[model samples]
Target: MRFALSAFAALSLSSAAFANTLESSAGALNITPMVTGLDAPWAVDFVPDGGFLVTERDGDLIYIADGTATRVAGVPDVAARGQGGLLDVTVAQDFAQTREIFLTYAKPQSRGAGTALTVARFSEDGTALENSREIFEAAPGFSGGRHFGSRVVEAQDGTLFVTIGDRGNRPSAQDRSNHNGAVVRINRDGSVPDDNPFVGQSNVQPEIWSYGHRNPQGAGLDLEGRLWTSEHGAQGGDEVNLVQRGANFGWPVISYGEHYGGGRIGEGTEKAGMEQPAYYWDPSMAPSGLMVYSGALWPEWRGDIFVGSLKFDYISRLDGGGVTEVEQIEGDATSRVRDIVEASDGSIWFVSVGDGAIYRITPG
Candidate 1:
């Protein structure tokens, strides 16, 4: 019966749990499970002392140190509902000295909730944060818990680039007057940058850096400080874009995807004055995390882009802008690859939400 087969499979997997490795076109990768039993971990950031700080979408912040996963206190209360919760984590460039940390989450409000960014100082013992404060809360706290695209990038200049999704409102992606569907820029203290694209414009939010994104959960800065983002489309048309200043990325106006019910969306994928995607996926991978790799680990992979796929349960390795996908790495443990980052030792680390675990990819 099916029960007998399921039991056999569980026994087989348990016996090989310690030696789980993923083999792909790249080669054999030794997969090490840093931590397990997480409630849908969203992202991970490394600290200076060989430890990791992680955020779970169910409103928990965890510290992985010396093979133990400990829940850290001081995380803000989150609207932990459908796709809304604590999402991304990042450390300050000078963390060894300042001990500052940044995170993005769905901040609860009376109207509903909105994506918000916060800054805090990590304690020395990795137990709690000090002086935590809300740095930026996206405008128009929405009613639904869907599409809070809360990815963040700490720019080289100490400024921040935060992506807020359209809050499930199809039309809001084209509305510049609100913070939804926009990449916002602000200083570390949450002050809007004077040179932002919409700073002096009327009927547009000053913090807007670029607008018209659908739900970009992936964001990263290239070596040259250029931002890149990957957004989820409705049915198909998942896109990877080179995010730029003062530019409008067509969303509802020009999508290659269709509505959930098979209806056409936008102006048929091309329109004047709207920026086209650097690349797009037709069948939809639900791309989440984005990272431009350095040659430190794989010399040939320098400048190669790695994006985690939520829908496809794989990692897509891409070339330069407008380039096609080169490869996808997948295995049983690579399910729902939510976030990807480069470690100090040059290994590629990613989180598997389906497994409630974190994994690392290194040269075989």
Candidate 2:
């Protein structure tokens, strides 16, 4: 069931080790880039059969089988401009029996106005989405198109972990009344969980699990069942944090990153009440997608975290416990990495935002 990259095509790039790289040698890693020429690929999810579903920012869902991509029809309309557009997608963990899939997109309102982060479920029948239903929608659509952190992961108890961006408003991140810039835990049916952090709080949405996030794009669960997320900071200080229930992560209030013009972001990098990041980067890689590798293909990388970077244009490898061993791997280096998914067979698949290509990386 495992997919193997041809050994004849091994390409090794110069090691651009960051502060997080392991001090000891961990053996060689060979990465081979497979498939090119896509149009802004945002996310990739494996189907029950051997194929995969790849979403494009320009409103296209491509079905790739045997390495050839075919466009699927009946995709809903998307804003498809600036930072808004068709975004992440995930197949239900019980997809083999249910054929259910979830998708996130920027729902367009006016000609130029839109609110990012809408989740919908659909049934797949070869080349189209059938029985599509919008499960959740962000409130108070914003005008500008930036900071739409829309990724979803199912928890062990069947609750859905949904990441929502700040909607270009920094103050809203601290506002408990709004859903922006917070991780919301809800039932799979889009209903707020009764046991949510702010369930009985006045003016606060019961779905808010955690708050004060600038822009969280990637989320995943470790083998220990701990939830982890990667958020983009202003100019520097991109972060990886272990998500805790009801924890407030300081965004504008505190950040290791300064403004693009070198202005102070908030009070400081650490505040008394706010939770600090588990790890942060200085240059801001603009991490988009995250996945933990426990696959057999890369035994040396087992239990490691693989993060796809948009600003750095590479893959960052981190040790399981936290951020340890950061190395920029080459594959679709010309494009921004959108999402990383470890296949059932242990091969890693990545989506490119710039060119929309889906690249499969395996041991060469």
Candidate 3:
């Protein structure tokens, strides 16, 4: 049985301990805790049969069910330094039969580390992953694990899209030769898709679908199957972009934010041929995970966009194509919210890294 989440239990008594009851347009929202005592959890995804899977940035994969959290084996060695370590995890499209899952993280490299994407099959008893193989590894691995931008999303056509960061190298984002600061498209078994933007190009990496990015941490597919991302800016230029195939998203060249110490970034925010962000925050939200609301639980929230604000300690809700911020839901405790997803039963779930717990928001 799923969580018997009701508004009465959460709203009747005044306790902000685990669940919080708040008033909304449609009705009361009951925010309940699913699990606790996690160590810097980065991403969470549900399994086909039962339970949910979570990844810890310190290089651990956990399975939580019936109030028990078990460590799943076969996680690769991650750098676990700076902001690099175990990251996003997603169950395969055909997980029931194939029992496969996809993962992304900062792969330990000689230079320092780079983001790597892989697919693996889970054991029959769900104890360990088998046949793990690296499907794609970002090029020109750099030192200092500042921005790995490791997030993987599967497309409706069975292809995968992986996000790579600038690796603290601003100019590398403009170079098509390296995989840094770009989105890559690949097949399930580490093969390149023929229809990729630069597949037939010379000198450019064939896997690159889009280039000129800073550090995109959150990747989500909208209801229309289009890819959307939330990226962190240097100081004050945090952005949300509608990722397009072969599109050139302006990074250091055209940004709404300035440099760290206070100078104009990249020609003062507007360029001749660079794509503008769908929406941006001047002071920065430090956005991480993104989700396009399906309106399953609350019908009024049909097409809204929800994002985890790392620096702001709250959830920002945006509306439609304009990407305007419509609402901000704050948690009881100060939390560096990491990942967000809509549960199958129509509940909104997210992982708070600073709080070290998982919470679900459902209509009360």
Query: Where does candidate 2 clash, by residue pair?
Result: 20-325, 20-326, 38-355, 40-356, 41-356
> Which segments of model 3 are wrong by more than 4 Å?
1-17
Clashes of each: 0, 5, 0
* Candidate 1 residue pairs in backbone clash: none
lDDT of 1 by residue, 1-364 (tens): 0012113233334434554677765578777666666678999989988789889899988887654556788898999999999999999898988999999999998899999999999988888889999999988647998999988899999999999999999789889888999999999999999989888889888999999999999999887889999999999999999998988898889999998889889778889999999999999999999999877867777888899999889999997644679888888878999999999888889999998877777776
Q: Compared with the true structure, what per-residue lDDT tens digits does model 2 show for residues 175-272?
A: 98877889888887788888898998899978899999988998888777778888998999888888999999998799999999998898988999
Global fold similarity of model 2 (TM-score): 0.87
Better model by TM-score, 2 or 3?
3
RMSD of each: 5.1, 5.9, 4.1
lDDT of 1: 0.86
What are the clashing pairs of model 3? none
Query: Model 3 Cα displacement at 264 (Å)?
Result: 0.4
